[model samples]
Target: MKRVLNVPGIAYGGDYNPEQWPEEVWAEDMRLMREAGVTMVSVGIFSWALLEPAEGEYDFSRMDRILALLQENGIAADLATPTAAPPAWFFRAHPEALPVDRDGRRLSYGSRQTFCPSSPAYRRAALRITRALADRYADHPAVAMWHVHNEYGCHNAECYCDTSAAAFRVWLRNRYEDLAALNHAWGTTFWSQWYYDWDEILPPRATGAVPNPTHQLDWRRFCSDELLSLCTAERDVLREAAPSIPATTNFMVMQNFDALDYWRWAPELDVVSNDHYLMSTDPESEIDIALSGDLMRSLAGGPWLLMEHSTGAVNWQPVNRAKRPGELRRNALAHVARGADGIAYFQWRAAKAGAEQWHSAMLPHTGTDSQIWQDVVRLGADLQALSEVRGSTGTAEVAIVWDWNARWALELPSQPNGELRFQDLVRDWYEPLWRAGIAVDFVRPDADLSSYRLVLAPNLYLVDDTGAANLTAFARRGGTLAVGFHSGAVDENCHVRLGGYPGAFREALGVRSDELFPLLPEETVGLTGEVAPDATGTLWSERVRTEGAQVVASYTDGPLTGRPAVTRHTFGEGTTWYLATRPDPATLGSLLDRIRSEAGVAPVRTTPDGIEAVLRRGPDADYLFLIDHTGRGAEVSVSAAATELLTGKPAEDGSVTVPAGGVAVVREPRE
Candidate 1:
């Protein structure tokens, strides 16, 4: 059975700020919210000025009225602490609160998240504000949950302020226990960079022709940990005041803010909430959105909140373009299909003045007469009609391993292959599976792979002992594995594991890649072998050898021409596929098909080009979300007929034509 939140249907509404507008507009706001079926509204965010007018003095008169207005309207509140954007007075009084950039420049109030996360002044103020908010709203019926500090982090690395430098020294002491251990971990012996005292240590250099990438990476990791502690401080205060209400920090998807390792903080979060914004020029833009949804669902271990996403054009990106008709609903349905408990935009109403003035909102300056308003109302009513699919969770027999620490380490390694990126490899494999209508699990390396029929480890360059053990166990237990180029070469410390590439799993994979051949962007190598399957392109080629495995594909190269480019080995009852070269998308698709047949994995539905579909079944019902990702319409064919849950119409012939940006959620009588 799929897990559900307090509500049985999709939770609607968004970030509302009555503080941003006049009280005369409150009535219209309520009417429009009701029209959109907004049951919840997050409030008190970015209201530090209203909450705290002075150091010791506090004011909640405005907040009290806002809460009363919302409660009277039967709207729940996702209350924020107003600690995210502290007032200028606080920063002026305590200069330590200001953040210093990597370039050693102290930042002023140009944006939110400019406060030093490790600053004592900031922590003290954040605790006070959070405690006050929780205490005041503890018994309020409209209070839904506590939203701690908006977005939590803004990629602030390279803080050399005295406050941060002092904290960094303490952080290093705790991590390495001693100067000697720190030197060894940092490999300081290589550049004669040994540190005699803790004070000699410095934050990673900001700019130079040859910067220490490894130190910069470690510093980034340390900064992330420090910010997490800041969140923990506020969380503890809230927990003390109100034990029942859930607490969460909003995460920006794919942002370089150090907390990419949510597994470390998932325990603290009641529900993982993330802000999703898809920026792509591809017609299949919804795939990027869908991928973000899957990533969020995996992070929370269950259903997560669609905390913040743009309904259309975002003012922040280089290009801000409004979404076409039906695109908003299509994006919303993607989140719902991936097990999101609630869906909300960044703002209910557009800001007239601020950094996000031009960002897309439900209500623009012109008010409810706008097209966006109508779209919101239509989508809201449509969502209400399809409430039965509330708890449907994505089911998949294929799993992909994602490791943030490993990703960070690999990018920061002081070695060859500086261009190696984790997201590139993961996306290369994921898109092919997605196109094939194959649902995949974004799981941890330590996750139990027994349930999955097939597993993919693309650019899994760094694997600890436990991860290696888990992969080996899965292979021995009759699970098919697909690993790509530059995998299993190094451990977490960026050191080669000694025996050979892939260490313990060499026998299981039945292949050993001794050398890595870097290719130029325009370089071409035609792959010709049994497994090529017509895949061709210059997407980073490599040469490999097979011991016990059979050569499936070979690269036509200089000296290594006709060398194994792809190999397959039968291990236990299953098999392992290794790709030495980065195959083109077509070849990867063919490889995916082959693996699906070998593992007996099945797809839910298939379309010509534009349409994407997935079936999620709960204990008593099955829900299908179909999306059209192409510019032109595409026809979808399904096995079972269903009732159009969005429209309550009977679906016939197991087929439906979807126009671009069109979406359908159907519920059928389960067999």
Candidate 2:
């Protein structure tokens, strides 16, 4: 696969808005960029007003100077199309371009991503600006890649305006081909809501009760497609005007922004880039970051780009806490360890004015005298030293299935339980493996499972016949399969599969659920056999019966005491495990340990708590990244004799020490 950027080492630097600063500050900014070892920067983002002050009139003078200065400093440019936030004049000329919320309130145009995606006026303006930028910078020596737009559908994912309604009608007609088919698919006969004409249907607005499940689901899909259409429309412009430059749009996959289906969008873009922000409320933010990186890399099918991260606290979170002394470096290296070819932050300098003034940046308001600036310089040097680590891919023996459709289905109103969340189940399963030094890949349900020894799907609430068949085939081919609660209960249309629960994989799993016994938030159940003695289950439970499976663990005390809480069955050459409830960490770890042993899967290396060991393999060399996420030092067992790329010293005695909040990149020769 072609790499995103043609840089020799890991590309560094971030979004640079030189237009926000004074003219003299531009030269100093370049000097500081060079001093900090910045090699690339994303310019022209959120500069639509400056780029085009009026319709049919354009001004590239400021951007021209910025590009020239960056080239003079030997820095490559990731040029943006500057259409994310249209100027106030464009909206004034076309008031219908603004998006409307589900409550029928028209959103104002003071912020970014305020235009409706389905508006033809918006599309025309976006394409015009894209063509102008591509024509102006396509031949520039500083241009390396084209940033299509900044974070598509970030704020304005779904627009319930008239334009969107009309486009949605077209989308529905294209999908169903006829009104009768649409009625059957949507199950519109319920509640006497049958549609007689295509125009009678509308985007699911706020109703007294839950809207039709299929209607809401289809609307979500349609909104995502609309935004994707906007992206592809501009991408075609760049592809024609600048055939050589690759194009990409930043994805916000960190917080479950499932408006756009990334799996569908991944194939259309030249490279996959993601924007992630830390959840200060969650203590385990590092794990979330790793999860995002792995998911993005999987979407790209190789190394991806960290398009936007933060230098410190952000402006949007409820409580934006600044990073500790070494937290910033640790976070950046974490992404690099997990198949990131490039790392960039949101902004280069702290904004003097604007909505993000409080947001941290590489060059903070304190100038170069602060610890953040010093750390930024040090990180740049570190990235330069470890440039050879670029293009290496992380290896994993286990794959966890994460589906956006399933997540959306699970979050729909009127489910079995109100407290059940898709992310909670995923973290419950992923945390144990992550802490045990076992590498994992976040995969889609239909992704190739032949190379993996084990596959775990948590809360796979929505499954199609193809996905179910794929899982069955994986198990039959000797791959261990583990599935969690509420899986295989429904099809793609949110309609329950007939006959029994876990409908499609019932035979393969050798089990069936007769009833779902959801627990209250404070409820808990005890597990007795073949698990941790003190193990307890919470959040969910199910009354399960075995057809041919053997009971691995049973509930000791609860509503369904003495019932099977976990079961295993041998199918052909492989085994299938079912977890009927959310097990505590110790219990989950014990179960995973058994699965790992059964599949002969081993960790790359062993480390103490707060330290992570990840291996990235290339054609000629294997890179081992040891990161200490704690304030205290930790030790790791290095099985192979390898040279530490950062220190140029050989790791002897099969052991290495990683300082508090430090990283060690070791390269071992591969046969």
Candidate 3:
């Protein structure tokens, strides 16, 4: 059964902390919440210091008052375990629980998430607090869901302390079962680092030279597993206390943050939730949000929650620029368009003092008359208007392969080009699809591909044998496969495939490479012939030869001039494309636009630039969500007459005009 948010329709609210303000202000907050139509708020996420000041010591006074206030105001509480930030007194007792950095420096407790994941003391304290909260709030009327230990690995993902080293060895023993197997997997023979005993193994600590790639990879895998183990441990306690409540921990699934493999973490979650904040510097931030929303939706395989996003500028960035007039609505609706059933922000009220004081909230420092507050109220009403969109989900004909392991390996030391980014490679392809107004979903390389007609794999640097086979079979069964450069070069063990450059996909793509010729900084390669007339590439180029495949394009002027830059091969009734370099966005979009056509994947609805169209189908109707990122309005045509949900107007003529920088959701009833 699909685990859904307990909110009746669209969950509209953010993180609420009454403890930050005086108790007298709680009534006003409740009034404001009702005015904003806020239905749910994550409570007590970082209240460990207030809830349990000392070890095993409990004080539910503050938490009880908050829940009672929520119940009185008709607001649902997304109750949190508050294990993300352990109290200072508890930390003082277990000083070793603090994380040790790679350089063997013991970090002091100042920021949140100071506890090490592998520390026995930290785990015990975290679970005890979780159990206490669960036992106290098991049948609380205001409690709607269980949020287990905030973002699992935001501050401390990998630790190299003595405790972590011991835990890593245990993890390795369980994984390999024997040192001989571990030796083969880690390629210990190269560095004369073979270990006969498990004690000799360490957690890939600060090494003089480039650490063993496989060893580093395994350590990363273990770090993700260790954090997940704690999450499930706390979640299990919650279940034992309150089995009726669904539990989830928010995931940092955005780009620039890649510590934990969310693909593995998603299945363990009762419901997938993600915290996405836009970087002010990113010019294409809107598209990035769409990418993240699709990923969250894909992780849940249906509806998801936008657990955290700012109402405006975030303080963490170097220069925090406030959102343009209509961006807040566009941002929230973009997630809804991508299949998020709930929309929430990081904070409900602005903080008077904190590291994130400048981070904008629903109620900003400017108060009720401010633009941010007005936007919040309007958005609440907007979400309420689109309540019919709940229970509907979007299905994409196109999927982009998202592999955390591949991303981890690509960023490891000693790759072809130090400048190339795995995240950029993904955006390079997805940008074109997004620009073309096509809907997309993210899929793990090994997951089901039958639902998608086109699969875009952008630089899968590390893929296992099973995943490689899965992608190959997906293409063989008539799915159009577009593979990016530097993909399929290494196995899961981080061992290079000896025969060719693109190891696992050489035959599937019908292309082979002798060597990779990385372009220097500011270098550009021109692509001519059949790919695109103006197609140019940057950062990477390769010597590629084709077998049983047509040369779609060739490098017109580069180190590999006149060689195949792009190839198209027909495999088992499907077509496969191989791109040897990072094509400029326009050229990439044009090429993918062609591929999207070859796969017979049509857009849900075509719109102008910066305006996206997506469709979600419910039991009774199909909802068409057209989100406008541009400040200008545009008219879009639909296939059938429908009623626009937000405006409460009928688009009886099979066409609707989206408001400038706003969304227009039209629902067409199922006949």
Candidate 4:
């Protein structure tokens, strides 16, 4: 995969909609961009209406002038296809392009992403605009990369209209190829839901009883594929027209809204870019940001781009709280520390009128005099000074298996517990590692695990034979493995693994469960053993029977009292640990500490609670990032003697100090 652009420093600046304002303001915008050390700007994202006022009518007068202005100002342009939100006139000409909800209600126009993914009219219009953009900007000096349709599948992931229904049937036919295979995979014999023909299957809609679990799972897969197909279609157009320019579409990573299978989509793009937003309600929002950056970097297999992040507040959230002083710079550096070669925001300047009017920008409503603008300029200078950190990659010895199919299967109805959420389980496992400043990489279940010392598979409810074989081999090869509750219980088709709970890896895990005992919302149970004597377990507990595993922790209360809450078993040369219940933070930390020690997985260097230390290594040098997320000063110990990049001072004693809500970038000599 392509790791960096042809440019020198980290790409700065963000989305610039020059068409939004008058011609006079455009020059001032360019001046401000150069003053702030901006190198790139994404233009014409939502300018479909202005580009093509009517069907078959193309107007590039405004876009041509905008590209020329960027070239004159010495700024690279990430040209967009402008097919995200089609103009109202195109929809009026072909109303069938609009999307429909689960209740069969056709959604009206006015909102963005209103078109159906499977609609031929929408595809035709989108491809036409893409071809035009590629043809015009292929040889333009200002164009650096091609930004495809904006955030595909963000608003319209699934449509329950006739077109979508027909498409779903076709997809199923292609996958199953025969009704007998479909029936066996879906387990239709029990509910008399057998399908004799291809047209019988429908998108899982709101019905009297919950739709078939396998059917719902397949629908989700189909929906993700449909959106991916749309992206690939536009990508093909740009590839044919402008073979030299790289194409990418921003991804909303770790967000709960869209269900697109990014694991499949990541391979098709030249660069992986993500738009991340901070959650104001969560106190540990920094960890969330780190997780997102790490996931994006892993998807790209190297340094990626921070496409869009808010400067302060977002308009869509219920409460748009502004960032504290220095918080924005800290967040931007956090992404850079995790392997982001570029840092960009949603927009350059605040919008005067739009759906995202209240969203914060680099240049806020208060203009250049505002503190936000000052911070933006300072960050720009900092990025320029730290340009040597480009093309570097982070190294991680821990891998966490993240499977979208397992997540989809866990959401099916009639599970042991309805309150169980897949993301919560993942977060529970990741928080401890994040707090310890231990770097982690997110990988698919089928990915190779031979490089990592420790692997965590949390809530891997859906396990195929290949995944089971991989985990078993990893354990036998002396790699430490940890499997969480409700894992390895079902097959790829959401069918039970017949003999016992967690049947696929019962022998590898060295444990078996006859039944799942889900606790009520407020119920709690105590745990007592060598691992965590005073810690408590809540949310879930299972009656476990160990075959060859030794009980590490046992329940002290609840109906399954005296049973094994946590178990450890020695395989050939390594060990596998299993937790049959959800433990509290203290208990989870204790378990992780033991595993970390056993696997020889240590942090880069220990710091205070709110200070984070991350290392990115290149061929010639190593970059160490120290960020203080707390509101007080922190003194951190560096792993080696290095010179701070921001301030050319050497910390030969392996210690440095960071102010409250500040960041420090140090370049260590490569050994």
Candidate 5:
């Protein structure tokens, strides 16, 4: 289990498209892959058109040479099912397979994922190609892993077509079983929209007025399930061919793309994999990467694969800013530090001409003289040194609750705050924890929280009965619970909790709010309590009336001036706190630091402010990874002698000096 690739070390190559170049270039690519210490390459990600030139016509000559080439060079192939993009001929043959947007416009072919997930024609064609690929190369020695499909639901997540309408009706039948239950759950009596028969229901498509909130939420859930079902179908085909090879589709588990609920999708795959890219606009991309890696690790419950990342810049951003010198190494190693068993990129070589021509790769158009190429070689050697840490696991002192259903229900129309983003609120709490060098794990709302000392719920707008009870029980059982603003206001049906604003968590947090008062975009509120005197809040405020809670921070100025801005409630044996407003970073950091001390939760390692420290435990050794996010060097004190993986040198004086923007992984042998 030490080597996820079934080899000696971590997997290091990326998406390899041999069809993009000439035959002569294929040989050169293989030579370079060996020189760069590449272990495996994902093939045929978007090559459906090449594989099947027309409907029912197959061509494996190009792929045949490529697989043979990989076998000859000793590099493994991550063979992919080219179902993400069906051939143009297939789309032409079945025009109804194209997805229609919610606005009633049928999108034309030409882009990837043009087929509808619920279309029978599309499903049949997709499976046929998957069967062909699996039949041809299931037993090939060069194939190491069976990549089921590319990133699912990236472009065409939802469809309002007639085919999808039928599928939604079927899914509703299975969920509610009867029209009475469906009507009751949807609150159909409110607007006289009750359905006497299942045929009366339609997707919450473009309408004259705002559609029912419950209907809208169910539509999104159905869409996500449709895609998951397709992914499972394809994986079944591959499994029938070869069950030993692990099969997975890349999950987009980062910011801005929250289509598929990975919690529901993770169980369908043989192995969990994710594709993470840095935001060119965000100054703190490293923290975002760390959080994404942690989420992937938590989803897999152990070491997961970093399926795709960018070596420098991605071509899709409006302003594609390339990574500076040594940034790629820092990003890759940070993922490894957070439990990524392997590191890969979007592409192995730069495209000569395509939609992604501007995307950066390990072997850029500038050849082996570029900074990316040099760093790629160095990272390969670094991963080789870190091979011994493949199977180790990362631990967390704190857990953040994130539910895709709650996130989907929170962003519906007609809310207190229109500009409120789910991920932004979660990141606001996560940033401070990362800066303190605290290892954090993300879990679903219903996940068991007894293992973590502290749990934070940041804007969980929709709470099911099980989740609400779980949160309350966790607090009652002596775990510190911190609930953020606008949380616990609604149930699974998107219906308000009637009695109070923060309904589900009011008793647990010992606070109540009958109404929420949102501030203007430029408004600011000052706080007067344990935080710094100049501590301020923004975006939201609430008129708090405590039932059995003590005020921790009061609003000095705002709609709820001189009222409680934050509250602390003592539950059965633990303490619960409610955050009424989003505090600035420093103020939030101070408050969380104090709370951590009170909860007796400590970081993985104590280091300078911006340095990231993560510990991974193994049978014979414990690997400690120190990532210097700070621009300057950081000196970390070690309690015993250790071996630095990157430099192959022993750490002196039980101390390691991490260079600025550099990473050092120390392997400490167990006693």
Candidate 6:
């Protein structure tokens, strides 16, 4: 079964560190929480030191009170296992708990997420701690879910110590079994990199300003897998003790951590949750948050939660800017519009003093009467009043394949230009569809892509035979497939797949380029097209020849001026389109419009360009979320009159203007 969430109400509140405060303050925290209408609280996030103050001794005295306090206040608590950091005692007792740098330097812990993933000592201690916590709190009525660990990722992929090197060899052995296969996979023939023994394979060349991207990339993947193995270890222990308790790990939206193979990790999770920080109030910011919400929800096709977010401003970033008065509400509603089952802020109250002292919270240290406090109260009240909206599903027919393995392997190309980045390519292609109100899912390449009308894969640089065959079968069965430049050049093992770039997809894509023209950061190319009035686009330019294809756009400048920047080839009832250059937002917007028109893409509503809309279908009725990102009021036209859920006002057939950074959840009766 696809993973799914069942949210009965808008999830509220976030990380609460009662361990950081005096015992007397816990009561007031609960009292203020009642005023803000908080329904949940995440406890023991960074309490590893308190939970395991000594090596062999374990303590839950403090967490017992925290959980009891949450229950007393009638609030559910997201209980963490206090495993993000093993106390200094753990590292001191077992030096193996500390991570080793790729340069062979032993790392000393100063902050969280500092343990070495491959260390059996660390794993043993972590397992003991997780099991202890589960045994104590599994039956606690207030303990709703288990938050596994804080953002899981390697701070520095530099564990070349004996333990890591040995682990790396084991990982390679599992992947290729022997040195001969490893030699062939890594293409050791050219550089005499062939290994006669398993011990000869070193952890990708580490240390330096510009390290070997491919090796570093593999190391990153290995490290992520190592981390996943750690999570799975603890997960097994917890599931054994408390078979029914939900388990989740918080993720940062922009941060890349192969933590658990998302495809593998997601199914085991009860609800996928993320911590998102939106620095801008731009359309891009809204899209980023919405996409994150979609991804989290899509993980198991269940209701996901906003695990952590600031109610106002944040202090961790270089620039700490505060959210405007209405910005918080707009952001929260937008998450709901996508597929969020629950909504929560980063903290219940701001820190009196700490690294994140100034980060915004529902209740500032000033108590519960501030503007943010009042806004939280109003927002909570709104959520409580509209409990009927929970369990609503966003209707999206389009699903974009998002492969974490492809993201890891393909971007680590040995010879690709710096201009091409995996994440950036995804954003450039994804942003337009998002703004156009198209529901886009991030699917793995191996996932069933036949479900969607149009499947767009941007910069598919690493195309394997199985993946190529899947795409081939997808197109053969009448599915429109589109791909961008620098794609299908290499295999999973980092070797050029030989015959032509895009190896197996050469027949499907219908064109081949002899060489890639790398562009500098400042270099610009021109898009020659007569689509939109301001539709010309530019980025990197690629010279290409097409077979059984028609040119839609050509480069007007550069040596490859007349080459087809955009080409289309029709096969059977479906077609394949290749975009050889990066196009600006306007041009991409026009191109996506063409695909939408031709492929019959579905949109929730036909709103103005910058104003995005989504339809949430429920058993009784349908709801539409109209989000205005212009930061200025917008005149939005409605197909028919509908009642605004956020405000009890009636939205009519005539243009209903919406305020800047504002959101409206309107209920439209099914026709």
Question: Compared with the true structure, what per-residue lDDT tens digits does model 3 show for residues 461-482?
Answer: 8999999999999999888998
lDDT (Cα, 0-100) at 345 in candidate 3: 97
Clashes of each: 2, 0, 0, 0, 0, 12
* Residue range 224-317, candidate 4, lDDT tens digits: 9999998999988998987777888999877674487789999999878889999778777888888888889989888888989999999987
Local accuracy by lDDT, each model: 0.76, 0.88, 0.89, 0.88, 0.89, 0.74
- C-alpha positional error of residue 353 in candidate 3 after TM-score superposition, expressed in Å: 1.3
The TM-score values for the models, in the order shown, are 0.94, 0.98, 0.98, 0.98, 0.98, 0.93
Native-referenced Cα lDDT, model 1: 0.76
C-alpha lDDT (0 to 100) for residue 130 of candidate 2: 90
lDDT tens digits by residue: candidate 2, 453-553: 99999789998888888988999999999989889988888889987777777888899988989989888999988987899999888889999999998
**How big is the RMSD of model 3?**
1.2
User: lDDT tens string, model 5, 539-636?
Assistant: 89999999899998999975688899888889999999999998888888888888777888898889988788988888888899998876797988
lDDT of 6 by residue, 196-274 (tens): 9887767764544454444555676687678777777777787787777778887665544443457666766767777
Task: Answer with 3 or 6, whichever has the higher lDDT.
Answer: 3
lDDT of 3 at 536: 90
Per-residue lDDT of 371 in model 6 = 79
lDDT of 1 by residue, 1-671 (tens): 22123543777888999898899989889887987898787898899878998875789998998888888988888888887788888988987678887677778975676788778888888888888888888888888788888776654534667777778889888887998887776777876778899888787656555545456556766777887888788877887787777888788755333454676766678768888876745555666776777777778765788888887788866777788877888888788887777888889999999989999888876777788888888878877876776666778899888887767776774545666677767878888788888887788778888789999887677777788778877987899988876677766555566755545467778987666676766666777876554555354555466778998878765556878878899987779888877788888778878977788888766567657777777777678787877767776665456677776666688766565667777776667
Q: In lDDT terms, how accurate is model 6?
A: 0.74
